[model samples]
Target: MPLPPTVADLTSFDLLLSVARLGSVGRAAAAHGISQPAASSRLRQLERRLALTLLDRSPRGSTLTETGALIADWARAAVEAADALGAGISALRASRHSRLTVAASQTVAEYLLPAWLVALHAGNPGLSVTLRALNSADVADRVLSGEADVGFVEGPAVPSGLDSAVVGADRLTVIVAPGHPWSRRRRGITAAELAATPLVSREAGSGTRGALEAALGSAPAAVLELSSTTAIKHAVAAGNAPGVVSSLAIVAELAAGTLVAVPAADVPLQRRLHAVWPTGAQPAGPARDLLSIARRR
Candidate 1:
C-alpha cells in the first residue's frame, strides 16, 4: 500500500530527520542516494501539502524553524514506526519460508520435546514449527515418507530407509504402585517373570511397547491395553497392575513414591532415542537448527 498524501512517504520524513542530523540539505540528499534538487523538491511539496514553512533555508546550511523542529520530531516518530513495521513484516516472511514439521513418539513428546522446542525458538525466533505425537513406528514412517521434516523416536533400532542420530537414551522400566508386591521385593525381577506377569501396557507398535517386547524376547502378558501413557501411569498408580514404561515418563511419580521402579536386573531394556529424517534428504532450515540443538545434548 502507498502512504497517504499528508505524509509524503517514510523516506521523505527520513530525509527531514536526516537533514536535521546531517546539518546540510545537500549532504542529507547525498547520504540517501538522491540528488539535492530532488530532496529540496520533496521537502517543498511536503511543506506545501501541510501549509507549513518547515526549513529556514540559507546559504550556510538548512536549519529547522520553530515549527520545523516540532514537525521534524513528529516525522521522526513516523519514520520509527515505519521501520518497526518493516522489521515485523520481514519476520513474518522468514517464518513463512522456514516452516518445520516434527513427529515424535509419546514418551519423547510428553517428556522431552518442549524443552528442545523452546531452545529452537530462542535461537531462531522467526522459525515456525508444527508438532505431532505418534508412536515410534509411526514417527519413523512419517519422516521416511516425507510427511514430516524431522522425527524423534525411542527404539532398539531406527526404522529402515531413514537416517538417524542417537540423541539420547531411555530405558524400559517396570513400575508398580507402592502397595504392590513387586514394590516390596528386595530382589530385582527377572525378564521371564516380568513377561509372565499380567501388566497394563501401551497398544502394540509404540516404541515403549517394542522395547519391552524385545527385552522379554516375546509378547508381554497384558491385562489391559491402553493408548495413552497418562492412562497407563494412572492405572499403575491405582495398584490395578504393574506397567512397563519409559523412565522419562515416570520421573514425578517415582520421586513422589506414588509408583516404584522395579529393577529388571537381567532385561536389556535400554533403547536409543533418535532424531530421524528422510534417507538422503538431510534436514535444512529450521529442521536443521532443531537437530543441531538436539545433537548438542
Candidate 2:
C-alpha cells in the first residue's frame, strides 16, 4: 500500500522538528543542507497534502503549531523505526559477508584449498572460514543441504540440482611400489588391463574413484578400498596393490620413489575440479571471494 502523502515525505517531517528546535525555517534548512526557500516550499507542500498547517511562518522565524508539535512527536517514532530497520539490515549483511563455510573433496582440501585460503585471508583480513574435507559425493550433499556455503569437487560430472563452475583440472595417476611390474614397463598399460586388474582404491564416493570409473566406463575391481589418499599411498608402497590417486596427492612420494606413477595408455585420466553451490544461489561475500581466488589460480 502507498504511504499517506503527509507522512510519506519524512524529510519534511524531520524539517518541521528541526524548525521547532532551531526556531526558524532558515536555521532548519541550514541544518538539513538546503536553502530556506526550498525548505519553506517543501513545508507548504506537506501542509497542503495533509490539509493541516504544521508551521507558523513569519519574518522573525518559523515555529511549530500545537498540531505540528503533536505530529512531530509521532513522526519521531516512524523515523526511529526506519533507522532501526536500516541498522538491522546492515548487521545481517555484515554477518553474511564476514563468515564462510566450505566443504570439499579430500583431494582438493588436502592439496589445493590451503593455498587458496591463505590468499583469501591475505585479501580479507578479518573473514572467518571453516572447512570440511569429505568425499566428492558428500561435498555435493553438504552444499545442497545448506550445511556449507560452497563446495569443491573433482568428479567428472556435477551432481544433479546444483550449479557448478570448473575451478581447476587434475589428473588421476596410477601408482605402485617401486618393485611392481608396471613400474618397470617400457610403455603405459592399456585401459582394459588397468580395469581388469584388482587395485587398491579410494572409497566409492571419492572423486578420484569416480573419474577412473567414468574413464573406463565401468568400476574397476578393488583389492582393497581406503578412504584417505595418504593411506592408499602407504598401502601401494608396501606392495599390497596398485592404487589410483590425484597427481597432487602423490607429488612427494613420486619424487622419493616411494610410489611410481604408471600411466594408462588409452584412458583419459584428467578431470576438472569444480566449485558447486545450490541452484539459483550464487556465492556472495567471502564465498565469492574464495571462488575468485580459485579461478585466478
Candidate 3:
C-alpha cells in the first residue's frame, strides 16, 4: 500500500526535530547531511505545504511556537519509531555506548546545562554526553541507584545519602503578566500574601517547587500546576496568575515585555545549586571534569 502524504514527508519532520534540538537550522542541516541553504529552503517548503508557521526565529536561536512544539513532540515519537525500525540492534548499541550520564534539575537543564555541554564538547572532541532532566529528588535518586554518573540540583538542602558540592545559586523570581494587579504594586508582597494568592506553579517534586515550599513553609495556593516550563510560562503570560519560577527561566519573556516581576519581600527567594554523586564515591573522569566546570561557572 502507498503511504500517506505525511509518511512521505518524514524527513521534513526529522529536520524540524533536529533544528529544535540543536537550536539552529545550520547545525540541523549538517546533522541531516544537507547544506545550510538547502535545509532552509526545505523547511520553508514544509511550512508552505502544511500552512503553518512552526518556528519563531531569534538572533540567538529558533524556538518552536506553541503549535510547533506540540506538533514536534508528536513528530519526535514517530521519528524514534522509524529509527528503531531502521537501525534495530545498532541503534541500541549506539545508545549504550554513551560515555557520560548526567541528571539535572529543571532549572539547570533548561538554563545552564546546554552551554556547559557545548563547552565540554569543544574541549573534549570525542566525548559523548547523555543528559537527564528531572527534579532534585529524582536526580539524587538517579545518582544513588547508579543510573547517573553525576547530578546537578537546586534546592534548599542536598538529599540524604548523597555527597554534594555547591556549584552556584539560583534566584527565584515572582512574575505576572504586565497588566496584573501585582505588577503595579509599589511594595513587595508579604510571604503570607504571596502564599495565599493563587498561582501558576510547577508540579510537586520539582526543585523549583521545593524551594518555593521551603520559603513559604507550606504549599502555595495553586490555581494551575504544570510539569513543563513552557506550559507554565504560557499560562502565566496568558494572565492565569502570578508565578514563582527560577529567574533564568524567564529572561527572554522579561526582555520582550511578555512578563513582569513583582518584588518579593519576606520570602527566601534564593537556593543553592549543587553537584551531587553517590555517598562515599566521588565523581571521576568525565563526571569529575563536568563537576569542576560547573563549580567554576
Candidate 4:
C-alpha cells in the first residue's frame, strides 16, 4: 500500500481536513488563509504521489472517494492530536500567566467556536486561546485533567469532577431526502414508526446519537453509522437512509432543498449544550468571556 502523502509533504493536516469538510479546495484554502490555486496544486501533488484519485471533481464541488474519506478521518485525528501536543508545550512554557484553553465536542467546535473565539478576542485582546475538538467524553477528560480551562459538550449530564452550566440548546431532528416517502407526510411520525425504519445515524458515543436514543427510548436499526454530520447529510440526501442530526448541521442542505426535516410526534429532541470546568475552579477573563458569548449566540 502506498502512502497518500507524508507529513513533510503537506504544510498541515488542517488543509486536508478542511478540504474534506468543505468539499472544495477554494473554500478550504480561504479558511486557511491561502490561495485557491495553491490548495488545488497541493492536493494534486498528493494525489500524484499516492497514485490514486482522492477526490471526485464535479461541476458542483469535490467529493471524497471511499478511501479518501477514511484517510480524511484519520488525518483529522492526527491533526487534532498534534494540536493538543502543541498546546501542552505552550502551557508548560507559559507556566502561570492567564491563558484560555477549551475542549469542545465536534458540533460545538465546528458550528459555534469560531464566533465565540472572535468575541473573546474582541473583548480581551491580550488573552490567548487554545481550542481542542473532541468527543463528549474527551472534552470532559480534558477539563478534569486541567488540559482545558473549560469544556463544552452536547450530550447528557456532565461527567463527575466538573462543574457545568447550560450555555445553549440544540435540537436533534430527523431528516430525509426531499423525495423520500417520509417527506410527503404532513403529520408527524410516531417514535415507533421511526424506530422500525432504517436510518443513518452517528456512531455510538456521539452526542447526537445519545440524544436520539433517549428521545426514541431505543436505537433505530442503523443502516449506516457515520462520524461526520456532512457525510450523514450526503448519505440521507442520496436517499440511502433517513438521518437524525443537529438542525444546525443541516441548515445549508435544508435551505438548498437537498433534504427535508421529518416532523416527529415528539418534536424538538432537546439537548442541553453545557460549558464545564473544574468544580472548584472559576473561569475568568477570556474563558469566561467566550462562554458568555456562546450563551448569547
- State each model's CA lDDT, in order: 0.87, 0.91, 0.86, 0.82
Q: Name the candidate, 2 or 3, with the larger lDDT value.
A: 2
For all predicted structures, in order, the TM-scores are 0.67, 0.86, 0.66, 0.64
TM-score of 3: 0.66
For candidate 3, the lDDT comes to 0.86
Predicted structure with the largest lDDT when compared to the true one: 2
Give stretches of model 3 more than 4 Å off.
1-98
lDDT of 1 by residue, 121-158 (tens): 99777777889999989998888888898999887778
Rank order by lDDT, top first? 2, 1, 3, 4
Model 1's alpha-carbon lDDT is 0.87
lDDT string for model 4 (1-297, tens) is 764446544454577778888878789999989898888788777777667677888888777788778768877767787789989998875653457888998889889888888877887776777889887888888888889888898886677888888889988888999888889889968888888888998887778887787777788889999887888889999865799988888888889999998889754498999999889888765677777888888
lDDT by residue for model 2 (1-297), tens: 999665777878888878877888888999999998899999998898889988787667778889999988988888778779889999999997888999999999999999999999999999998999999999999999999999999999999989999999999899989999999876979999999999998998999999999999999889899999999999999975889999999889988888899978789999999999999999998999999999999
Candidate 1: worst 10 consecutive residues by lDDT? 92-101
Stretches of candidate 4 exceeding 4 Å from the true structure: 1-98
Candidates 1 and 3: which is better by lDDT?
Answer: 1
Task: Evaluate model 2: give its lDDT.
Answer: 0.91
lDDT of 4: 0.82
RMSD of 4: 25.2
